[model samples]
Target: MIVKHGSTTFLKVIIFLTGIAVLALCVWLPEIAIRDARVHPDTAFFLIPFLLCAYGFCIAFSVALYQAYKLLTYIEKNNAFSELSLKSLKIIKKCAFTVIFLILLGIVSLRVLAKVTGGDDAAGPISLCLMGILATSIITAIVDALQKPLKNILELKPEND
Candidate 1:
C-alpha cells in the first residue's frame, strides 16, 4: 500500500512539472516569435501564420495534458483499468495525432519558405518540427499500447464481478 501510494505521488509530481513547463513554453514561444518578427524583416511575412499554428499546437497540447491529469487522478483512485482511463488515452491519442499533423504541415511550409528565399535559414525550425513529430508520434504509440491492456482489464472486471 505504501509503495503504491508513493508511486502515485511521484507520478503526480511529474505530471505537475510537465504541465508547468508546457504552459511556460506556450507563453514564451509567442514572445520570442514576435521579437524575431520585429528584428528580422524577412520573417515578418510569416509571423501571423507561425503564431496561428503555434496557438493551435498549444491548444492540442493543453488538452492532452488535461487528459493526462485526469488519467493520473483515476490511477490514484485505483481505477486505472476502468473505461474512463481508456477514454482518456483515446483523447490523448487524438491530440497527439493532431500535433503530428500540424507539425508536418509546418515542416512543408518551412521548406517552401526556405526554397523561395534561397536560403537554409528555415532549416533549424524544420528540424525542430521534425523532432516534435517524432516525439508526439512516440507518445501516441505508447498511449495506444496502454489502451490495449486497460481494455483487457476492463473486460475482465465485468466478468470477475
Candidate 2:
C-alpha cells in the first residue's frame, strides 16, 4: 500500500510538472506569434488561427493531464478499478480525440492559408501537425484498449462483491 501510494505520488508530480511546462508553453506562444507577425506582416492573419488552434490544443492537453491526475488519485485510494477511474480514462480518451481534431483543423487551416498567401513552406508545420495527430491517436487507442477490460471488470465486480 505504501509503495502504491509512493508510486502514484511520483506520477502525480510528473503530471504537475507536465502541466506547468505546458502552461509555460502556452504563455510563450503569444510572444512568438507576435514576433512572427511583426517579421512577416503578410502572414499575420495566419498566426491568429494557428495561435487559436494552439490554445485549443493546450486546453485539451491540460484537461487530459487533469484526468490523468484524477486517475492516479483513484489508484492511490484503492479505487483504481472503480467507476471514477473509468470516467477519468474516458475523459482522457475524449481529450486525446479533441487534440487530434484540433490538430487536423489546424492543418487544414494552415493549408488554406498557405494557398491564399502563396506560401510553399508549409511542410514543416504540416508534418508537426501530423505527428501531433498520430501521438494523440495512439493515446486515444490506449485509453480505448484499457476501457474494455475496465468495463468487464466493473461488470463482474458486483457479482464478486
Clashes of each: 0, 0
Question: Distance (Å) between predicted and true CA of 124, model 1?
Answer: 3.4
* Full-model lDDT for every candidate: 0.84, 0.89
Model 1: lowest-lDDT 10 consecutive positions: 1-10
Clashing pairs in 1: none
> For model 2, how does the per-residue alpha-carbon lDDT over 82-133 read when each residue is reduced to its tens digit?
8998999999998898898889999899789779888467899999889988
lDDT tens digits, residue span 1-161, model 1: 12377877787788788878878888898789878888887868877777777778888988898899888888878777778999999999999999988888788778877887786688788888889888998898899889998888888988888
**What TM-score, computed on C-alpha atoms, does each candidate reach?**
0.86, 0.91
Residue 161 in model 1: shift from native, Å?
3.6
Model 1, runs deviating above 4 Å: 1-3
